[model samples]
Target: MNVGIGLPIGDPAALLSWARRAEAGPFSTLGLLDRLVYDNPEPLVALAVLAGATSRIRVQTEVLLAPLRDTALLAKQAATLDRMTGGRLVLGLGVGGRDDDHQVAGVPLTTRGRRLDGQMEVMRRLWSGQAHGDGAGPIGPLPARPGGPEILFGGFRPAAIERVARWGDGFLAAAPPTWAGGLFDTARAFWREYGRDGEPRLVAQVNVALGPDHVVDEARAAMHAYYAFTGRADHMVAGLLTTPGGVREAVTAFAGLGADEVMLYCYGTDPDQVDRLADAL
Candidate 1:
């Protein structure tokens, strides 16, 4: 599996520096996690800036909450970023689990699944230069790739896997490496069942914290804040690895599972987290 790092979303001032640090390290991709009701940079905009900062590293939305945004606008944003990044953008779509995100978007949570399926069709068509509603012309600054950025979706539920086989390039899942093998197996099985012509790309991501005693503590604190919405922050805190040994262990375990890429998300936003993880992996 290829190793990648998430660009820290906090401290917007330091975001680019973190991007540069990750690009300079052993990371193959720089990823972002999207949150609507949180203090975080808008992910697509973040990539627009980071695109100019690094040339070799691929960029992805670890998983973006697609149903929350207007599909046409989202397609335009992603297409522009793909052009700017030289086709390095991998779009990961999902109906986020947070009810508040849907509430704020004025989107009914129950309809998200169906809406996302339609949105995927719309976005892919728009990216392919298809004419829009009425007399609107094809989207400009066409995607760097002819068919548009490679697309993936989050989760491995029956419906989600069906969506992937029908429209997406692969599956993007989040779980500790040790717990991911079964998930990968299920997705690949469904990929074949649907008669997709080739193997589906599988991406896995895990949360970690690797640094000094203080930074480790800070990392846990950060997770507590982020997962507070789930009412299981304490549960998540207990599993976060805080050492280089733990980080490397998970990466190796996931590599054995055949993940196309496994991204490590630092619980702490310390820019040094990038170098530390690269060294560990």
Candidate 2:
């Protein structure tokens, strides 16, 4: 399985130092998380900065919130990023689970799932050089490929998995490997039903921090801050792997579960965190 690392879009100092270290680290991909209505930087913009700063590392929006932005605008930005990155882009999308973000966007929390269903098609058409019905043509600096990027959808419910089967090129499970394995099965079943060949990409994510005694506390604190909007920070923060052994064990487990890739998210963004993860690998 391939290993990737996520850079924080929250704290600037942490993002800068850790992004540089991560660029030099032994990771196959570099990624960012998305959110609005917070002090966090915009995800696509942050990704653009990281892509400009690094070479040979695939950059992506690790589940960009799609329905919050205008569909055509999102497509243009994604295609632009694809061109800027020389085609090293994976667009993992979802209707994010936070109500505040939706409120901030002035869109209803309800109907996002349905909205994304159509949004997916619109983005594809724009990427394929098709114009919107209003005579607005394809966005400039077209994608490096016919389609914008490899599309992956994230969520764990039946409807969510069905959407992945219908529209996405793959599935991204933000849960633990053991939990993600079941969702992977659903995704595979739908892939075959849709007449796709081989397999759809399967990616897993784990929040992590590696260090001596004080690192666990740091990681825990970071998790609480990072997931504060989730309303389940206490439950979510408990999953972080703080030791090298735990990290190795989780990687092995995810590989066993047939994951195509797994990304490690560092909440605190200490430079040592990236180096230690690289050494652990």
Candidate 3:
């Protein structure tokens, strides 16, 4: 199982330290959460900083809200970052689910899905130097990877799976239990229909809490807080907190589900908390 760590987008200093530590540790990639109108920094820029701080660890946007930006510009930025990182960038795209997110971007939520599809098409074209006559000229000096960064679509719906098959390199799923069976089935179907004759890459994100029995409650509470803050309380109760196994069971379940890579975001932004989780793993 390939393990990756999440970089805190809300705290620049802590993010830099976490990126450096993750690179120095056993982690394979560094991921950033994306939120445009929120106080967090832009994902691409945050990735650039992470690239400069780490040598081998790959950088990824856990799920950038693609419908909220200019696709051509986003593609150009991604290509530049990929080049700077020597082609170690993964662009994880998603249509924002929260209506407030679109409102903040001045984009109507009603058109998010269509906007995402259109933006992805334009972004792919620009990345491949096929974006001319759309008035956005060429995005020269592409990344070392011929086509550009690996594009992964993030969603659990059937439409999302089909979109990945049509346009993405892979699928980025949420934590297990909440996003296991249905999500995997959709990915497999998409792969059988449109993927190469090999295992399709599947990336998942989960909260991690590692320690003796002493910290189990703290970890559970932290995980609960995460879901509540994200408005995913229903999932937290039904999929996460309903069981006694907690984070460890959740992590093992994700790996057992054939996840190619799993990124763990410690419930809180505490570096010590992350360290505890890592040590336990």
The top-ranked prediction according to TM-score is: 1
Clashing pairs in 2: none
Local accuracy of candidate 1 as per-residue lDDT tens digits, 1-281? 78888766658778788889888888888888898999888888887788788898988897899999998888898898898888999888888888889999999999999999888888888888898768888876689988789888888577876777888888887887666888788788888888989788988888887788887888888889988988999988888888889888887788788888888877687888887887887
Which candidate leads the pack in lDDT?
A: 1
> Which stretches of candidate 2 lie above 4 Å from their native place?
228-231
TM-scores vs. true structure, each candidate: 0.95, 0.94, 0.86
Ordered list by lDDT, greatest first: 1, 2, 3
- RMSD value for candidate 3: 3.3
lDDT of each: 0.84, 0.82, 0.74
Model 1: lowest-lDDT 10 consecutive positions: 1-10
- For 190-267, candidate 3 gives per-residue lDDT tens digits of 878884577568888775544454344555565564456577665663442222255556667777888888887543
What is candidate 2's lDDT per residue for 150-208, written digit by digit as tens? Answer: 88888899788877778888888889887988999999999898888888899889888
